[model samples]
Each structure stands twice: as structure tokens, then as C-alpha cells.
Target: MNSKKRAWFVLGITIIINILCQEYFFTEQFINFNPGRHNILYSAPYFVIGGLLYLYRKEIHNWMNIIGGWMLLFCLVLNIGYFLLPISDLLGHSLFPLLIVFTAYHMYALGSDKKWLHNKIIDFLSGISMEIYLCHMVMFRVVERLHLENYISDSNLNYVVTSVLTICLAICFAYCVQRGLDKLLLKKIA
Candidate 1:
């Protein structure tokens, strides 16, 4: 199959798997594995969607330029409805993922061409984003171990402080790891 055909096939399969795992085969083990809405099954479809977006980005960009505003308004209405209305289980299961995709696509489309988003800090953060993801759980644990929550008296203030500290720690750790990997790769290449 062609690349486009293969991408569509994979996208379809992942979407089917996501719906099945979420709606039908959501067993206790699955629930345990995917605590606090961190469902691994959903990742597959989203990854595939991202790939598809990149694959057809030029076409998608043209289409977005034409009707992006209308789509954004539609998404806004759906989002309002989602929050205001008592959604049924089936709709909630389906609509939530759709909303996420729409929101992410709009964000990407809007930000991808912005000159202001091309700053040095943004570039550095983007470079280490994967590393940050890998190290964030450890940084969260470090924050908990340090008892940063109690460092502040007010509950909300403590939460905010700890959250900021955790993010800063995670970013620092990720930057160090990225630098180490770069040096190691450079040595191997040399």
C-alpha cells in the first residue's frame, strides 16, 4: 500500500482499538493500568492522528485556512454544550475524544505559523519535550519527598508552588539528560 493508504489504515485500526478498549473491554486490569485517565489505548489513536496530520499537513493547512474559523466556532459550541449539558455515557465517551482532537488540531494549526512561537526558550523546551515527559514523574516524586506542599501555609499557594517547583525540576532534569545524550552521541560519532 501507498504511504497515505497505510496511514489511513493504521488510523482506522487504532481508532477501532481505542473505542473497543474504552467502551467494551474496559476491564479491572485495564482500569488499573490506566489510572486517572492516562489510558494507553487512547495514545495509539492520538499518535496515529498526529502522524496523519503531518502526512497531510499541506492539504490540511489549505483546508484550515478556508474554514478554520467556522470549525473553531463549532468546536466552541460543542465545548459549551459538553460542559453545560448532562451528556449520556455513550456521548461522553465519544464526544470527549472528538473534542480533544478538534482542540489539538486547532491549537496546532493556529500556532504552527506564528512567528512569536519561534523563540529560543520554546525551541529549547521543544527539543527536550520527550525527555521532560520521561522525567516528570520522577520530579513529582521528588517534590513529594521534599514536602514542598507544607513549605507554604495556604493550601492553594502550596499547590501552586509545588506544581511550579515540580515543572522546574522536571525541565532541569530533562535538559541535563538531553545534554548527556547529545555528548554521548557526539563521542560515538567522533
Candidate 2:
């Protein structure tokens, strides 16, 4: 299989499975599931992808190697930071999958030479990652602002409602704002 196609396949499958696990299994049914377990599962694909890239390092693009190096360094820092900060399951669990994404990107970017990835259009969409990162916090604030919490209890139904609301707002409002900002910034940067 072509490396690029393989990369996208791995990335897409990984994302879909992770989201399904979070939304359905972890949140809806197994509310008490240990986050650490899910983190490992989430990061598994990245490890495989990263290993493949490392094994085929010679065929990889130099820019990918450069980006992968940075991602590795970043994961190293995050790992160390987790160790020093007194490990919280929430933070550790969340960071693990991202570490995987960093690894996958390193592998994908290294294996392929696609300058369009760094082009203004793609860069703008990528910039929305920041918005995705902060969406939960923003969602929480919005929920609080509307005093929606007062009516909802910590039950399965409440979980569904909250998750649905958060996902919707995150996808709609937060992403939209992020895209707008990214476009504005792209014009200046590009």
C-alpha cells in the first residue's frame, strides 16, 4: 500500500474508533471506566504508525523527519512534565492520545512530501486545533452561563444531554470561530 494512503487510513480509523469509544462506551455506558485504559487504546495506532515510519526512516521526507523530531521532543517533554507534576489520571489519559497524534503526524509527514499541508488553506484548518483544544472549557462556560447545570443531575440522561450539547457547541460555535480566526490569520501570514 502507498505510504500516504496507509497513513490516512491509520489516522482516520484511529480517530473514528477513539471518538466512538469516548462518546458511546466510555461516556454513555461505562461512566467509571478508567481513563488511563482508554488513553493507551487511543495511542496504540500512533505507536504502530510511528514505528513503521522509524523503520522506514530512509524513505521518509526530510521535512517529516524534522517535524517528527519536534513531535518526539514534545512528547518527551510532556512525559516528563506528567512525571513531575504528580500524575493526574485526567491529564495523563488525555495527553497520551495526543502523543499518539504527534507520533502519527511525524510518521505521515516524514513518509510524504506534501507542501500543501503547510499551505495557507490547510494551515488555517490546522489552526482550529487550538479551538478544539479549548472547546471543552468554552462549553463549560457556556453551560454555566445558561445555568443549565442547575437542572441536570449527574445521571445517564444528564450525561447524554451534556455530551450532546458540548459536542454540538464545540463543533458549531467553537469551530466556526476558530475557522474565522484561522482565515483572518492566514491572510496575514500567507
* Highest TM-score model number: 1
Instruction: List, residue by residue over 1-190, the lDDT tens digit for candidate 1.
Output: 2488898899778777777786656768555454323455766766676666777778766766677566566667766766677757766466354647465555555435445558898888889989998888788778879886556679988888878988999999999989999999999999
Local distance difference test values of all predictions, in order: 0.71, 0.63
Model 1 lDDT, residue 62, Cα: 71
Per-residue lDDT of model 2, residues 1-190, tens digit only: 2576676677567766766676667773676655644365555556556655665777666655567556555657765665566536665445455655466556565555557557876665456655755676577567647655578766677767876787667767766887688899999999
TM-score to native of every candidate shown: 0.62, 0.33
The number of clashing residue pairs in model 1 is 0
Return the lDDT, model 2, position 123. 69
Question: Clashing residue pairs in candidate 1, if any?
Answer: none
Off by over 4 Å in 2: 35-43, 59-97, 100-190
